[model samples]
Target: MNIWEYIYSPIIIFIASYILLRFAGKKAVSEMNSFDLLFIVVLGTIVSEPLVDKGIPSALSYGLVFTLVYILFSILTLNNKLRWLLITTPTVLVRNGDIDEKGLRKARITTDELLGTLREKGYATVKDIEMATMENMGKVSVIPKSYARPVQPSDLNLFPGAAFIPIPLVMNGQILMHNMKYLKLDEEWLKRELTRQNIAFDKLDDITLASYNAKGQLDIDTDNDEGHNHNPYMYKPGNTN
Candidate 1:
């Protein structure tokens, strides 16, 4: 009735309602069966009464507690039945480049919605998708067919298949003076690399990422190009084959 009472009542009711809702289990909105929907509607109505009425009664409070217990028990049973309820589990919207029409109908998802999800994943055609699943979280996950996936350098016949890992040589105009010492190379060699790139030693601050090859070449990348390897000699001259 008072401001303090109003605030405390809402707070208490919210805490209790949250606990009940948590005990109501993890059925997603899309995954809720008909009975779960009824329980949700009833739970909402019961929780809303305290907000609407001027005073809450002991009987109403007891009734809400009973309803919460019943709902919790029902949720436990439903969660147990989840193994048998194939519909509640995420349905395969597409499989092996074919749309499962029965699954689409059961999931109540429109063709347009499916298309939109595919487009969001950069897929222009259904043939590109090997499998698509409508997750319980209401998100669509798609796996592109092997043929539809991006062609790697190896697939393009450009891979030498050598195991190589590039390590940082310099960063932000500060010579990794320790790295030079590790590779038994001096600052003078690094300066020569900077000279070859026509960039000043002090101006290496413009570099965002830099690495050294097995051949001890200082590779430099600038912020202007998203730190891509700007080294002219990444591939030697006339070796495009």
Candidate 2:
């Protein structure tokens, strides 16, 4: 086989692959319905055929044709009249805190699975749920009874501080100097804060993780912390490599 075949075949396949990826990847795997998943699985096999047989031109053509068909089918699903042909409608699994056995059987989901899904949604038991439905994407949507739901801050007329994303300032017993500089923090300030936390400045290597938030808070985890161990960093901060 000529070496040029390697470069030529890949470039042809890549153009076809990009179209499939660009359009078909709009939804995450967890969000794909049965038809969508099947289409993707079949299209993937068609795209890979070229790699196995070196049938580059024909494989690319079939791959692109199927991709366009999938896209057209997807667009048709947007219309109410055509949606029924494309996707399965949601099934009600629970109604008014009572399990709908028939609905569960229709959805092919066992009672145990329904209870587990409800638990994951933060409901301890079905008694608090007004409705639970199995969506087309295979995820459960749980709605709690209004009276049984937890109260929100709005209900108490209280405003709390906005949550801030925690920035990593240290990891694996080494300071992330870039993040510290981003936060306008210096080594002296970090040492002082560690000292205030009763951690010796000389024992920085004992720390495995540290993060700071905009709420003027410093959180630190040492090697002794659960699920962490004392592993020294291979390279110190400020290394270009």
Candidate 3:
């Protein structure tokens, strides 16, 4: 109701919410089931009531007290023995290519859901996985069998140059001046390159997208030709491949 109450109440409530979330554990919020979602909705309504209702003078004080109690209990859950009692541990859903039916039942995850997740990760069958863990956060992490894993570039002693994230230099015929500056490129340099590519400066208005990276050639697309075939090996000494 007063200035001090308006200021301190929100700060106290924010601290309380943070402490409560910390106690709830990361999984409780991230992998929220129906119960967790309901708890959060109820908690929000309860905490916010005082701020909206002019008649509730004691609500703010009560919220602060409740927050303190929550903080104390949260600290107690830090002990390893007590933590297990409060929080769900990661469940081993698959081990050595065998599905753990008991673990799936305990986690309340269906066989269909497990198979779907495995398929999403490109594993067609459980036998392809050496280990699969259902993390407390409800994410499935799979370790493929060594034979099933794809070979890395490093395994062949290949020294591919450093990777560069492509930067968009132009979109919808408009030059991205900020990106050009970030890439330490000037308008003159871009215009010169465009001219070399036979992209007339006057016809830049027809261009839709243009992007470049350190290791690759500049790419350009134009709105004028929706079905234009761009040659990959089109040669430009310094401007393109």
Candidate 4:
């Protein structure tokens, strides 16, 4: 009911929620499994208790309890016997270009819905699908028949070496010295290259992103720094100009 309670409740709860969520395991909502969803819903309810009649201490305590339970449940799901009760099994809906009517019924999806899902996955007809399965997370995964799939280099007897992930030399206008070191590059090399692109040293932060690819190419993207805004409450970085 008090203003102070309203102000402090969200701040305290946010910190608690973040810590608990990190411990609980963070991932995109779309990628969350059933147990993960349950954990999130329970956490939301527990953290929101402080906004009601309950105190922050009680809410955080309850959140910790649930997080422990989530961890235990995660461990239990790893066992084959316990896994059946914990996790939903993936169901095959199509195999060998044939639709499994029983699988469709078990998955609770209509034929029309299956057709739409196939279309979204780039398959125009069921005949093109070698296998389509309903994953535990409710995503429909489709594997096209080999003959129906796109041609690849292997099909033409061509082999290309595997590539490594792209590393960033700079990000958000700040030099990633650690990454530069990892890539065996130094500050002087990066500074010289940015100068060639007309990116002044002081204006590096205006660049939204800068990445160095495996092929020895530097990609840069910049935003209008003239429209940059700063928070009055925060300490501002010193400007060169």
- Candidate closest to the true structure, highest TM-score: 4
On TM-score, the stronger of 3 and 4 is 4
User: Estimated TM-score per prediction?
Assistant: 0.46, 0.64, 0.61, 0.81
In candidate 1, position 36 carries an lDDT of: 60
What tens digits encode model 1's per-residue C-alpha lDDT throughout 100-195?
Answer: 998799789998889998999999999889999986546788999999988878797796757667778777656777777888878788778889
lDDT of each: 0.73, 0.83, 0.75, 0.85
TM-score of 3: 0.61
Error of 1 at 241 (Å): 45
> Mind giving the per-residue lDDT tens digits that candidate 2 earns over 1-103?
6999888777777777877768665752447898788877987789878878988778877877887787788888899999998889999999998999999
Candidate 3 per-residue lDDT, tens place, 78-125, comes to 798887776568889999999999889988899999999999999999
lDDT of 2 at 76: 88
Q: Which residue runs of candidate 3 sit more than 4 Å off their true CA positions?
A: 1-87, 202-205, 226-241
Candidate 3 displacement at residue 178 in angstroms: 2.0
- lDDT score, candidate 3, position 136: 56
By TM-score, how accurate is candidate 2? 0.64
Question: What is the Å distance of residue 173 in model 4 from its true position?
Answer: 2.6
Clash pairs, model 4 backbone:
173-204, 173-205
**Model 1, residue 94: C-alpha shift (Å):** 1.7
Model 1 worst lDDT run, 10 consecutive residues: 79-88
